[model samples]
Target chain A: MKISIKRQYFIEQLNHCLKAISPRTTLPILNGIKIDVSDDQMILTGSDSEISIEITIPAEIDNEEILEIEEPGSVVLTGRFFVDIIKKLSGDFVDLETTENFQTKITAGKSEFNLSGNDSNQYPLLPEVNDADSLVLSSAVLKTIINQTNFAVSLSETRPVLTGVNWNFNKDNISFTATDSHRLALRRLLDKTFNTEISNAIIPGKSLSELSKILTDSDEDVEINLSQNQVLFTYGNMRFISRLLEGNYPDTSRLFPENYETKVSVNNSEFYHAIDRVSLLAREGGNNVIRMTVENNNVELTSNSPEVGTVNEAVNASAIEGEDIKISFNSKYMMEALRAIQDEEVTIEFFGTMRPFTITPSESSEVVQLILPIRTY
Target chain B: MKISIKRQYFIEQLNHCLKAISPRTTLPILNGIKIDVSDDQMILTGSDSEISIEITIPAEIDNEEILEIEEPGSVVLTGRFFVDIIKKLSGDFVDLETTENFQTKITAGKSEFNLSGNDSNQYPLLPEVNDADSLVLSSAVLKTIINQTNFAVSLSETRPVLTGVNWNFNKDNISFTATDSHRLALRRLLDKTFNTEISNAIIPGKSLSELSKILTDSDEDVEINLSQNQVLFTYGNMRFISRLLEGNYPDTSRLFPENYETKVSVNNSEFYHAIDRVSLLAREGGNNVIRMTVENNNVELTSNSPEVGTVNEAVNASAIEGEDIKISFNSKYMMEALRAIQDEEVTIEFFGTMRPFTITPSESSEVVQLILPIRTY
Candidate 1:
């Protein structure tokens, strides 16, 4: 392949595909990025066996010439080396040509690099998923769903299914749930209709995390195609394909408590800061447990490291009604849950001292968060 | 101690002292910052045995009230905990008071923390350095000297003296030199008169690294007092004390070549970028050696990793007048020396292949940098 392209634009596309080329890939070929150049555009692909990302750079964009192809060809170059050279080049445009034996020569300004590339035919092909069972949603909504639930997924691989976020779709809505058994986070979108053949699937939390990073906060529609073993996400000129986790996800639908004896409405920042201070002392010890007491419309947090010190902070709450109660839970888990809510105020409901409590945004109950209380008594 | 101080101002001083509190400190008391309250000012000190930092907050400064001292007392609080609390407090002012059993009450806004405090008397005392042999320097000059020489200090403690920068005082200049045996970076201030008792001393690289961070970019004069075992730096109500490295620093005054067969003048940035690109290939393996060929007034750089590829670039030079030379050297060392010089153009003097070379600013020879060449067939 012989082509000269805008260095800056090419670097951006390279980064998106390079995300899938993990350093820990077992397959040596996966560490290289496959670049296929046709008459119309150039496609860059990277994969780690679990997730594959492909980005396209067309010949001309917005009437501005982006790429000029002298000869159409293909080559797989080492991901990090090519990326570094492209970014550090001072020239406005970079020229790439594949010589005999798949040797690629890259030239920009006075710097030229001749890299030994593998034959593109040796690279593994991304799983093909037809647009059959496809569901479309706005990028913002999809990113929100990923952010709110992905953090709560299990980090352990002992239960492979728990390492993913469980997705269930109905005729009118879709809900995402993730839990590490110690805590659960749930987010649901009721407006969009998810009409497709697939009703449920467990997507790895890591895959969704990477997807969220690349998703722009625009109203652009992202089409998701699901197959038996793979799920494909396509938006703009980029395609992301991830392998679905096998095995049955835990039934956490009944994990949230139904009744509560106490309810408190607290400002996110105020409560967050209070808990952050109290956790300072709690973190001094092995167990990050902090006690919280809600009474007289005020929430008080207390934690102490016997050898270090103690911390007591009073958090202002808008409303605290019903029976006053004191409970203890892991401060870190609760802090992560509160940050994910992204709301000014949240309503926290407690069933009892030993039972799990739920926190939801005060304006909407679409996002539900639950944290099991620690037996501190 | 009982005092109420502006939280923002206090946090700034706390950060300066916290630099001395290392997590690897063997003495537990060293991890705590000692706060001493007097009628006129409050002093905060942190030490990890190797270095100590002290900052003072007066009751009034520049017609602004910074601290209100109610009583005179002393106590030591854990460094990280206290610093974290001060930074996160939303209140304009923080009130600190030591109560029974040395438990300190820290109140800021609605957040209060009761922390266990160690007796201030238990903390190690900072070494006293009188102003007998003193040197005064502008903060900018001091910071520049530290930055230019510190990066070249030996990180390995095998030759403990090499881990520090050797400062030799001349009648009208002070020369700072550091070498890890592979490469040497030397910077000399020829204008400053040395009117002190001490002729030379070695300061630890770590101490200078921390001191460089806290120095501001102003022309404010800084007082440096040198003692037998300690060096104290006083500037803007802050005192930084570092232990001196004992033992004879190696004599390398003759390392610079007196005669060179080749002399080349090159732009700093041009040569820097070329070496950086070439290193990308050499770094693929363990050795970071890159070849340079200077002939016909152009410096060509080439490097290759057998498994990766080869990179070649021509660096623009203003002049290359001397015998043609082919030399190999570590690109990382060259890049670092170039960055530390802070010069637009430098004149390079090469003795020959496998011989050490010297680089100095084309404008002047105040800052001399040396790099040893590697022998390659």
Candidate 2:
């Protein structure tokens, strides 16, 4: 394949593809990025078994010639070197061509790099998804949902399904849920046009996180298609496909508490800072257990390390209803949950002392964060 | 002891002192910062045996009350935790008070922290430097000289003196030299006023690096004092004391070659970029060796990895005299030397294929960089 493209734009696209390239040594060929030069566009593809990303640079963009194609062919070049070379090349445009013995020559300005290439055929092909069954969502909403719920996914391999965030699409709404058994996060988009319905599509948390980073906050639409074992997300000129987790997702609807023994509403920033300061001492212990006592309308947070000292902080509580209670929990889990909550004030609902508590935006029920209290009796 | 200070300025000073406090577990009291509040000024000091930093905050600066010392006393607080607490505290000013048993209480806004404190008397005292015999130089010049030569210091402890940069303060000029046997960097400041002469004061590279970071580029003067086995650097309200390496520094004046067989001058930026590109491929091997061939005023740079391919690049030469030569050296060393030369054009002199060559700014001889060529044949 022979193609010349703008160095800056190509570098950006190559960086996107690099998000899917893993440095794992299991597969030697997977370390290279597959490049295809078509008659009208040049495509770059990268994969790491579980996730694959492909980006296309058309010959012309916005009436400007972005790429010039000489011959339509395909080759795979080492991902890291190719990227570094392009980024450091001193020119406005970069030329890439393949030679005999799968050798690729890249030139820009007065610099030339000859890199050994792997056979494109040896690279794994992205899983094909049927586009007929797909749902469209705004990129902003998709990014927000991913950032909010993806963090709670279990990072262990014991339960594979728990390592993914479950996406359930119904006729009227779409719901996203992630839980690591100790904590859970659920976000819902109440009304959006959906062409299909999915009961259980467990998307890997890593994939969602990467996709969220790639998807800049925009009003543009992103079409998501789900197959039996693969899901494809197409936005702009890029396609991101991820292998779905193979297992059944547990029903967590019952885990969220409906009736609570105590509920408190506090300013988000004040409470987050208070807990953060207290956690500095709590973090000395691996469990990071910090206690919150709410009596009347006063909320006191305290944590102590055995050898180090203690920290006691009080945050303003705007509303305190039902019975007052004292609860202990992992400070890190609560901080993570609070960071995902996008609101000025948050209301936390506690079910007695040992049961889990839920923190949600005080204005709406669209987002819910639940954390199990540490039994530090 | 009781005091109230602005958290912002306090944090900045604490960070400077933190540089001296290493978590090496050699001395338990070294992990804490000793704070002493006199009648009008508050002093913070941290030491890790080898290096000690002391910062002073006056009761009033520029007609602004930065500190309010209710009483005069001293206490030692955990360096890391104290800094972290002050950074996260929610208030403009933080109140600190010490009670019996050396227990310290820190309060800001509604947050209160009681931390275990070490006895201030146990903190190691900084080495005393005779301020009468000292030289003063601009902070900017000191920073520049440190940055130019500090990188060449040997990181290995095989020879203790080699791990420190030798500073020779002569009557006419001040010279800074550092070498790791493979490469050497020397920077000289001509026509500087000197109070005394220093023949062999080897300041540790780690200490220089930390001191360089603390000294910002400014016209403010920095006082340098060298005593028996310690060097004191005083600037503004901060006094940085670093223990001198207790060994004789080798005479490296003979290392600079003269009457070169080949001489070449090239654009510094272009040549540096070429070597950087070639090094990308060369770095695959640990040595990072790249070859430079100069013929008919044309410079060609190339590097190859056994399994990977090669990189070839050319940089424009402004002047080429003497005999044409082929030399190979570590690209990283050459690149680092090039970075220290602040001139747009650089001159390189080569004696032979395997001899140590010199790279100096074409405009001035204030800075000189020498690197030993790798023997490929």
Clashing pairs in 2: none
Worst 10 contiguous positions by lDDT, candidate 1 chain A = A190-199
Report the CA-based lDDT of candidate 2 relative to the real structure.
0.90
The DockQ value obtained for model 2 is 0.85
Q: Report each candidate's C-alpha RMSD, comma-separated, in the order given.
A: 1.2, 1.3
Residue-wise C-alpha lDDT for candidate 2, range B1-377, written one tens digit per residue: 99999999999999999999999858999999999999999999999999999999999999999999998899999898789999999888999999998888999999999888878998877889988887788899889999999999999999989999998867688788999999999998888746565565899999999999999999899998888889999999999999999888889988887899999999999999989989998986556999999887788999887678888998788888898888999998999999999999999999999899999999898999999999987
Model 1 interface DockQ: 0.80
